[model samples]
Target chain A: MNLKSPREQEYIQQLSIDCVIFGYEDEQLKVLIPKLDFTGDFWALPAGFIQQEEDIDEAARRILAERTGLADIYLEQFRVFGTAKRSNKTFMERLVALNPTKLDDWGLDLNTLGWLTRRFVSIGYYALVDIHKVNLQKGNIDASIQWYPIRELPSLIMDHEEMIHIALDTLRLNLDQKLIAYNLLPETFTIKEVQELYEAIYERPFARNNFQKKILDQQVLERLEKKFTGAANKAPYVYRWKRY
Target chain B: MNLKSPREQEYIQQLSIDCVIFGYEDEQLKVLIPKLDFTGDFWALPAGFIQQEEDIDEAARRILAERTGLADIYLEQFRVFGTAKRSNKTFMERLVALNPTKLDDWGLDLNTLGWLTRRFVSIGYYALVDIHKVNLQKGNIDASIQWYPIRELPSLIMDHEEMIHIALDTLRLNLDQKLIAYNLLPETFTIKEVQELYEAIYERPFARNNFQKKILDQQVLERLEKKFTGAANKAPYVYRWKRY
Candidate 1:
């Protein structure tokens, strides 16, 4: 990836945006992590810097669209990562040790990153996209972007891991609203399906009864007719999110 | 009230911190606002800029300590307010129109705020302070710091009002945890007290039955023996947050 052109433009180098776009498929919660290094080792969330004219959220949306070629995704600003120690120095050291190519347009080494060495306080945004839609090749999306299960993420650069964890917690906190907002579930679904989705999201199992009771407590669901089954008493009720 | 000194330091000029410190008194939720104008009218949240060496969170804590003279308060990083149109220009216009003195040490007019006119995206932090504790007169707290009920807030500067609203929403989302975290209530309180606290927080009334059910669902509270003396069933059960 060329880092030279961003400086050529009027990008806000000291502030950046990192997006953790989460998708669910095959009962697994996956996050889109781009391999920023040619060695296929260094990974980071889809990130970009803000331009002088665009808003921070606009920059995040632009970066997401650039990577996935989609829009109107479920996105939320979770938190900002601005520790005193959060600078390019650590990443700078990593790049130097790994010896990645294309340092800059100039012959400057990693240590001489100049103003690039200044601390960048990144604004973290997390998006919940329908996997089938964003992963579709129909859009002007990059074919090289990869998706990895959130739990199985490779070692990420910077504080992205911490960002993901906080994003996950925020997701869990607003799971009901997000599910409703994005139509994450089918129009109607059984308790088992919802439980499976929750399990995929939380990365843990839930007791059937406990799951049922808690889900109902949210009042986001309205019970529909039960699914008729050959086995008596085994038919579970189908429910739809009361999106009112 | 003075903005001249911050520029003299190695402050992160383009990024700032705005705090929405919520305190409860007499069953009313109040927010701290500092009047920034000599006109004694222009109000904004207690805010400051991050230093080059301090962490963002550290900057917020330091600002809180500087204003309240207290530490270890319940603080949270909710969201960052970074829109394209955010700048000191509007505030500058207001200052110029109002004829506020101390325009600048350099006699620069509002039109030439220089880099200060560049969009300053603020990280919004919120704190849940015990009104009595922070309002105490022991620390290096500003004597003129004022607390206004959320409902009766004055006209705010920039996007501080929007910041405060979102902070309150975040507060409601984590009310149970925040309450328990801060020991916001006495060691033991009645269901009515809890409901009142919720009412004060939510700034709305809930049917007694509905509020009780909602509070119980959180499961943060444990019921204690009924206070004897009143007519039998009229006496309510005492409750305490189950810290465990």
Candidate 2:
């Protein structure tokens, strides 16, 4: 898409939105990232410009849906990144070099190029989604879309790494409030699975007995039937989130 | 204060920042608001435009300092308000009617006025300050600056009421983490004072024994000398925040 089109000029120029979509799968935390179409080595969080007529939250939800193909998920605004030099000139120059022909075909003038390369203050939003439910699609500006382990994320473009850091901090803070975790877990999950998820996100091992007691104390989980492994002497009980 | 001047055009036009400075005094939660200079009945959170060369957080701090005449306070970015028609036509007409001569003196043409009255996306930042510490000052664009009890706030302009609501929610969420409250309290305080502060902010009574036990369990407070009441049989102990 030509971001510098005359029609696009009606939108706010110096503001944008970026979403950090967190998903849990295979006993690990993951984040969705898009490979920029032009820069082969550059990855970015699913992000887009805010339309002139939409609310900021609406813009974030629209971007998240467009990229992840999921709606009605748990989404939140975490932080705003507005450093004066966030759009680093070196990164812009590299991007331009990688897509000179594409830029020329877009009919973008020097003024438009300068405008595109200028600093932007982007609002960061984070979404918690069930990994198996996502229908990811590569957009026009992205060569490919994939989920990477949160702890081992590839080098991302601009300040997305910092954005993810802030998002994770926000998630951690909200963890104690019992507002998350359900979004990352399956409808039916073993207590061990729940403990592992917390350990993965918190990057610490919790004592099994203590963790179970603490989580059960919240009174938001419903104990369900035991999962039988045939060979096991005693099957462990599973639980599901009780709707409040 | 002529926003239409050539020098003022160097700043970003579409994005602005507003600060909700919360103060606690006389056992009441208060917020500082400025009476708009032009519109008689209009009150607003201290707000200003973002300079192109500065970071958004820096802009917020500058605005906070400019109005409160204090620095090194606790400030946080809470939310971004970006509705399309945030600048209501009625408010604009009222402002223009109140300041027709001032507008003309600033050489503001109709196009400039229209641009000024167009949609804007503002980042909301909240500051927590000790009421005794702030050197409040009224700016050129404000008829007066005053602190009103949070619950008894006057009608505010634009979406400031919503912003204040979000800020209070943020503060409440952080209260449990024990990361705030110190900003609103004095350096030394009695347990009763601390409980009263919490009660005032939450607008609910907390059981004395349970509140004391919970706060002491955090292990961040150091017991000081007893605070004597003239007719007290046993004086209550004072506590100060321990520097970690």
Q: How do the candidates score on chain B by TM-score?
A: 0.78, 0.89
Interface RMSD of the candidates, in order: 1.3, 1.0
Give the runs in model 2 whose Cα sits over 4 Å from its true position.
A1-7, A98-102, A105-111, A222-238, B1-8, B98-102, B105-111, B224-235
- Give one digit per residue, the lDDT tens place, for model 1 in A1-244: 1354436247765778889888877888888887764343667677777877888888888878877778777688988888888876677576666655545434656554555667888888988777777743212212256779877988987788999999888888777654533345545778788888889887789999988898888788888876556677766677887866
lDDT of 1 by residue, B12-106 (tens): 65788988888777888888877664453667678777888889999999878766777777688988888888987777666666765556544
Error (Å) of candidate 2 at residue B47 is 0.8
Residue range B119-225, candidate 2, lDDT tens digits: 78888899999899899898767788999998899998878899999999988988878558888888988889989999998999999999999899998889986
Best model per DockQ: 2
| Deviation from native of the Cα of residue A159 in model 1, angstroms | 1.6
lDDT (10s digit) by residue, model 2, range A104-138: 77786545656667788889999999998899988
